[model samples]
Target: MRILYVGDAACLPEDLADYIGDMGDEWKVETVSDGNSAMFAVSNTTVDVIIVGPSLPDLAPPVLLGQIRTLRPETIRIALLQATEMGSTPSIRLIGVAHRLLPLPLASETVLEAIHSLEELRDLLDSPRLRRAIGRVEHLPSPPHLYFALTRALEEDEGNSGDIAQLVSGDPAIAAKVLQLCNSAFFSNGRAITDLRGAVTRLGLATLRDLVLASEVFSMKTGSNVDRAALQQRALLASRLAARILPRTSAELGATAALLADVGLLLPGVRDERQPLDPDGEPDERPGHTEAGAYLMGLWGLPMPIVEAVAFHRQPQRSSLRTFWVPGAVHVATALAGNEPVDEDYLKSLGVLNQLPAWREMAGLMSERIAEDAA
Candidate 1:
């Protein structure tokens, strides 16, 4: 795997590069000082991942991320910031935009973990069966116009809740989805959610934004007889589990990170194949559904953490220096939700499972939720 580390801090970038090399003999790492240089390098070469610092002199994190999405959409982009930086409003927005966000005070072990996660993601992307499965799902309705309007409003200095509400109300489908989600078991606020404006007020903008994305993705009526209901059930269960676990972490923006973890898999570009459940099937060399999902999310301008979570859920130990709880939680949640047995040896080899507390707690919670949803 080749990675481009973009940042102004010479020490941090070099340290990250060295860490990647030391952790995995397979990695080919490079470093750049700014977005322009990073962009130049990406255009000239194929990079598996790009890591950027939040405090770049040439470009803000959000702008750099947006440009990367437009230019080298396939390159997985991650942003590095101090733990304190995660709480700022700008940082929060950047978290919404970048592929993954890692806390500073970097350590070699953390860096290796994140890189390994990325490697797992790359492997998943190359899975031929998953790619074919994703191909069958039809394109969901594009809500880009709504997303644009909402994003613009959020960007405005004077943007108010009313403005966001009005924009959301402009699209009846979005409005209906908002109300539906707010009223569903997902929200479970005792009071009924009867109106779009009220739903927006109650859910808040960030949650609303994510919910809108989720609803749009789920609404796609793929004609395939594949277990669409089961997939959705697992996704919802994973999402809710993440939401529940995030508050326990000290990390800021943990909730948002957790909520968007599996979004990569839901993206249009990730190919999902409905194949026979045969363990003896021939291996595929092409990038699989997970990798396709990660690539597509990178294209769609999702925050790096969310993209990484989607891409690396299958293998969390391979990611860069951050112990991202989102992807970890998704792994546990998805397995539990699907009633799939955990392979302890396989997980231990990945190097992330032991870092987590016993899966029994998470697995039990996920099982209960899945059973309730089924009921």
Candidate 2:
């Protein structure tokens, strides 16, 4: 992997060169002092990753990152953000431009770990054609304003269910979807939830936020061949079932992962990519919805666990996971919600086969309730 670091000598990690050297010839690093130099380097050579520091002499970090995005969209962009820079203009702009953000005064270990994760993701995805296709994609969905508002409300000290509900209610369409999902049999308790506050209280802040995000992103693409409404319903149901499968602590993350599992299907060119041809002229296996979705999440700078879970949700055996965690829960919930068979062999390998019956029971109840509602 070739990395281009755009910053002053002061901002670059002193040990970064040594670290890359230790990783062998597979890794290479190049440092440029200003935005002009960074642009020159990117335009001239193949850079797999670009790191922009908070302070740049010529062009601003955000501007430089934006140019990099346009010039080399496939290159992974990481920014070094100062603590005080949070909520600033450039920082806010970086939200869409940078793939990941790390603190300034960078620690080599943290940077290395982030790089390692990307390396692992590349290996797991293992399709240059898909990677380039996702890289060139310009119309990736942006999380709606409602998601940001909900996030801010959650961050406040006195934020509560009423506050969250009120924020959600400001957007009637989103509020209706939230309430609808909350009342679904997959998420519904014994009683109906009429008010937004009641629904928010039942769903919890994180899950509520995920629902809003999902609702708006799904709403963005209309008139496509894909039945987004039906797809959204299945994703929401899978999210609820995933939450049920996992322990309470990881439930919200699991739900988020499950909710966005099929997001790639919504993006243009993801489902339309042509399969690569082998030397023998046979068509090679193409990257599926899981990879395209995972690539999008990663580009959006979502948490790595959520990205990983989405990537491997369909094929858990492809991952190096011996124990059931977020990926496992998402896999089971997605399969169950879609009325597909679970990978019992994979579950048995992880020694979690005994738990399948309870999950199936949960799915069964969901199906029965849906049938009743439809009738």
Tens-digit lDDT track of model 1 for 69-162: 6787666767787777655543445656565567777665655566665556655555566556555456633434565456566656446677
Off by over 4 Å in 2: 1-118, 123-128, 135-138, 155-158, 272-287
Tens digits of lDDT, candidate 2, 67-95: 99889977878888886654343333564
Worst 10 residues of 2 by lDDT: 269-278
TM-score of decoy 2: 0.64
TM-score of each: 0.68, 0.64
Model 1, stretches more than 4 Å misplaced?
1-10, 13-51, 68-78, 86-93, 108-152, 155-158, 226-234, 248-276, 279-299, 315-324, 342-375
Candidate 1 lands at a TM-score of 0.68
* Number of the predicted model whose lDDT against the real structure is largest: 2
